[model samples]
Target: MPSAPTPALPQTTCKSLDDWNEPTHARRIYGNTWYVGTCGISVVLIATPQGHVLIDSAPEKASVAVRQNILSLGVRLVDIKTILLTHEHHDHMGGLASMQEATGAKVLSRANVVDVLKSGKNDRRDPQFNELAGFDPIVNVHAFEDSSAIKIGSTQIQHIPMSGHAPGGSGWTWQECEKGVCKNLVFADSLGSISDDSYRYSAPDSLANALRESSQRVAKTACDILITGHGTASDLLARLDGAKPLLEPQACVNYAQAGALRLEDRLKKEAVK
Candidate 1:
């Protein structure tokens, strides 16, 4: 399918480096998949006839902006039934509590992620825990193992555990159809090996191994379209604007390779320092 035309959205930010929480117009990814997030973060809404399932709820400061953005796409606030989480960081899921209340949707994530959100703090197990931020306590959160999945109507949304960058980190994957054509879609979380000062990626229990394994898993998943936590990670905005191919068979592999390469370089630099 050809990509859709993107409206001219203003170039706005939160006045902080790497934080673009300002609201932007929503656009369709494939058939039922919609991108209703801010300029910096990416939030996916899989709308089904029965209800909807949102991938991530941007940062907390943009809570209302995200809600309005979803509403702009003609989605009823109450119709959002389930919210699938990706990473447990404040930048990624800080607004989950408000989103859960706004839509009255149940939150689902990896078994270990449930604890971090409940405490409204960063996970100590994360490499960047020292620099991470906290958010409002998320309620009605439940745990799902690798074998389990949540659904929206007939769609089966599975949670893929990608817990290297952030402990208990995970991504959401499912299929969406348009004109009797189905495409595999994945809301992949951040896979870069980012950390605070004094943290090493070359330790005995270093997360580098997990990051590499997760890359392999995502590469094998074979998604038609891949969405990352940050729009620039996959050039999502460009893809949506028809600047790039909306469907790329090698996109997942390329994404996985890029993430793995980043980790490889980070480890190499850490060793020399």
Candidate 2:
């Protein structure tokens, strides 16, 4: 039987986007720590004492809505010190350049994402990448080879490299909540489903191995909350026995593999039909 869904909190945004609604289903898992994000789509903003850090940017059209929400909170756009790119896809990096121009926030992404955005050399010819390619030169991008620590007020984030989503895909771990009680890890993409855009590229086989390895590592972490790219912050640890956790990129490859297998079976059944 399927598990019941968690009730979402009341959504409040500064600006409205007719295309997408504010995330009304966000849950406050730990005290002073809420998943101010939506299932399957969102640009998660973490408020720390040091400054604000955005996980990803929403689509081009939704940027205004996001900016309004931040301003509504009485937070200046300039206070946002970092805009982390989860991937190079337009949905994830859509308002990157604009946000940077408006707030002077530094952009951090995997080297591959930077390369693709700068060079447009990837095999996939999706228009989103092209759009990102155009923004590459305008934005100030800083590349991190592996894991790094970012301190924001009371929150301490550990940025871990879990490539596959992007050559430099990463997840973040919040050491302790503001209330000083709960500790959570934002798996970012390490233990989550692939974004819809992964369909554009023929995901390499090595990506699966990377995800499997990353999942195993994530499974061993002390995180109580796992924020994925899509879907909800699952109690994955609570149901590890029945669940199969794969990293962000590995999960993409697995998802593609599963689709291929399903298609083959469908073809067999349809031939008989």
Candidate 3:
């Protein structure tokens, strides 16, 4: 007898691209940390009495809404004295030129990323450079070494280099306090092995080794709350809805492990090809 016919899988429809830039009301993530980016991207504001530190600026098109989000939080854009980045992708740093021009905030990131930021050009080292566009140039960018501490008022942000997603990709760790208790907040870089059709994880120039080491470091890092470059990756919305605990001690480890598995799978497919 013939085998049973295979059942068709459910078809998935692409979500509306407009939803990516739609203005979502800003909300406090925890303590002084607030979410101010779009529904698709992750931008965080860490408020300090002296000033404020913003992480990532979304794309240029959505920057105005991001600024509005900040204003809605009762924090002046001028009060943003420091701007840190998770990576130098156009989607992440596209608005740096506008935001920095408006606030004159000191931009900080890994040295290589700073170069890319200043040039407003895609870094050749990036695996997807040919498929990506450059953003507005940001002048006088400063470099921060891995594990360096950046202090703004009472808040301290530690930079951790995780260079696999992007050559200068990095993550941030900080402590937010409320009611005499503090929680460690981690903003991890994009960890998925995403690329255009022509790109391969098995390419000689791929930063697979660096990415593996970075994933290991992230797995070992202590985290109470985890935030990622994209909201969906870390379930930022579900957590905000009170359905999930604010403090997830093992979140980073899980994130790293998942990323590692993705890398392994990509390499396996490449080997077969």
Candidate 4:
């Protein structure tokens, strides 16, 4: 791994929950860890007794800043043992190259995604913009199919298969955090279609039906937290109605939204017919 010439972190004031009032890219949680946000992405850094497990590394530009933010919470780069990629999207896996070089940490993501990442790089006409970022945090990767389980120290991670957003889309469930604290299932960018509440989509009916099924499968699981690949963490317990499952998979919401849109289209067609 090559090292970035410039230092990743500069001298900065200690950052913590007391300093939450201050504008920072990270926020301290209950455990001895921090949640750092990058662009529309966010990652969880766990300070386990064994070492550290970072959910996802941000873009190369944000890697140094993220490192500084984490150190502010009392963790060092050398302590990071593993970097996990939810998928191979640039926003989610962007800063991996820089972080790996600086910390010499192992990178992990789905095997199928590596193929996509490689294909993007080889396309001469339209090279994958992600590789050009100079943050290839994934030189070495551990590929797994759907529902595969992996371990990092005391952490037991189960990678759930999610498709549409990317071929090898997946999520992780952390069995234990520092001090035996069990965190919720971390779904990496499981959202297949339908953007956030900014605009309506015009997807075909067949696509909408498929999305609904995807959501149904995802929402069936029981978890406390829903971590979106785009940096939003939703507490499923609070969002759930008595009838709905809490911490449903990302597919649940993505499909529901698309289904609603498709339903409207069907009703309109019926009216015309």
With candidate 2 superimposed using the best TM-score fit, by how many Å does residue 40's alpha carbon deviate from the native?
4.5
**Candidate 4 residues 20-94, lDDT tens each?**
122244554324435664434566786676778787776655677677766666667888888777656556676
Off by over 4 Å in 3: 1-19
Over 148-210, each residue of candidate 1 has an lDDT whose tens digit, in order, gives 677666888877778788877787788888789999998887889999886788998878788
lDDT by residue for model 2 over 198-267, one digit each (tens)? 3422334435445445555455455555555444334332222234442232433343344344434533
Tell me how candidate 2 scores on lDDT. 0.52
TM-score, prediction 3: 0.90
Instruction: Kindly state the number of residue pairs that clash in model 1.
Output: 0
Worst 10 residues of 1 by lDDT: 1-10
Question: Each model's RMSD to truth, in Å?
Answer: 3.4, 8.9, 10.7, 8.8
Runs with alpha carbons beyond 4 Å of true place in candidate 1 = 1-19
Give the count of colliding residue pairs in each prediction.
0, 6, 0, 6
Model number with the top TM-score: 1
Report the C-alpha displacement of residue 61, candidate 1, in angstroms. 1.2
